[model samples]
Target: MVPPLALDIDGTLTTPEGTIAPRAFPLLAAWEAPVVLATGKAFPYPVALCQFVGIPERAIAENGGVALVDGHLDYAGDPERVDAAVEAFEERGGDLGWDGVDTVNRWRETEVAVSPTADEELLRDIAAEFDLAVVDSGYAYHLKSPDASKGAALTDVAETLGHDPGEFVAVGDSENDASTFAVAGESYAVANADETAKRAADRVLDRGYVDGTLDALRAIRDRAKNGE
Candidate 1:
């Protein structure tokens, strides 16, 4: 059985400053399962990450808005939900824009990039008012569609690969990752995860940031291999 692994970037895979740890490369090189980077960063960021991680083509980009498979732009899902969400944002006095959506490698999942300087606080307030889940990535904010989520994106990839959802593990460190953790067979959070994320996780690592995240991945991989 192949186990799929979904990893979050930023505070999870890299430090808060966006540097991938040196220890990570070797471990990633040895990974046997399909590894997906699930993040809120845009194509350029994930494209850079794919170069660094040596998986330059196989990745999900734009938070499920785009899907890249085997170095190609395989799928770009409907933007109806995101479009509606954007309209709602505008109605709330928030201006959000996307240059274009594509499945570019850089991070863990398919993602759509909102303007880096988008007004996050206002977006969050609007999201809350509309009962939507707002993901704040410091540099940008995302309003997830009811059907578009990291978990849903991972499920789509797993299905395409003929893997069971129950065989996959997910690890993340923020509110955006809440759904990702919730849908995984086993889920984890770094020690520094927010209250909501920590509460949603099945386990919490002893460390935080890249160190904690790498350790958590190793633990999950080992546990699966050993049937622990």
Candidate 2:
């Protein structure tokens, strides 16, 4: 069987214009392995995207803060812990309502995504204050529990679908995706990815957005056919 593909949302799936590439939907449908939408978007958004793509394989949302299965959200982090983290973050003048890069804090559960201008160390300190963790998600920094992560969510869903964590092709274009890259047997980063993510990936695609993702997927399909 072809290994599953764990995909990042934002910069990886959408073009620079922030629209899903027209070719992406069908390619996702025809792919050999399961396609999991792993993103920082809220739980419902990715699930809705799955419906739009006509595939409901599995989805990881909120930067690994939760997993959506069978139309129900499976909370991956302690709500109380996350709330405490949020309080601490705000008390230190860290904005929970940051919208610097076209992102809003509305409707997000378990974790909060702040503007890119946020101080990483300060955020980490806040997380540490509440025994939580802060992760960089390319466009923003995320505050979540230390154990809640995209890699763990991917592995969890992969196992439910009868796949191994190491047999996946994780693809992304952000620092948050580094965790997924670390766990996957193979990882690909889009041309627009941050340096940290590019370093984590096994290969960096020449193109950006879903086109580059399709390019990588087609390459993977070819390698599988060749028994490579």
Backbone Cα, N, C clashes tallied per candidate:
20, 0
* Model 1 segments more than 4 A misplaced: 71-133, 224-227
Worst 10 residues of 2 by lDDT: 96-105
Task: Tell me the lDDT of candidate 1.
Answer: 0.67
Give the best candidate by lDDT: 2
Residues 89-162 of candidate 1 have per-residue lDDT tens digits of 78877766544452322232322345557777777666566555556554456565445666776777777767
What TM-scores do the predictions have?
0.75, 0.89
RMSD to truth, every model: 4.9, 2.5
Candidate 2: segments with Cα more than 4 A from true spot:
70-73, 99-103, 118-121, 226-228
TM-score of 2: 0.89
**Residue 56 shift from truth in candidate 2, angstroms:** 1.4
The TM-score measured for candidate 1 stands at 0.75
How accurate locally, in lDDT, is each candidate? 0.67, 0.82
Model 2 lDDT at residue 104: 59
lDDT of 2 by residue, 143-178 (tens): 887788899888887777788889889999988899
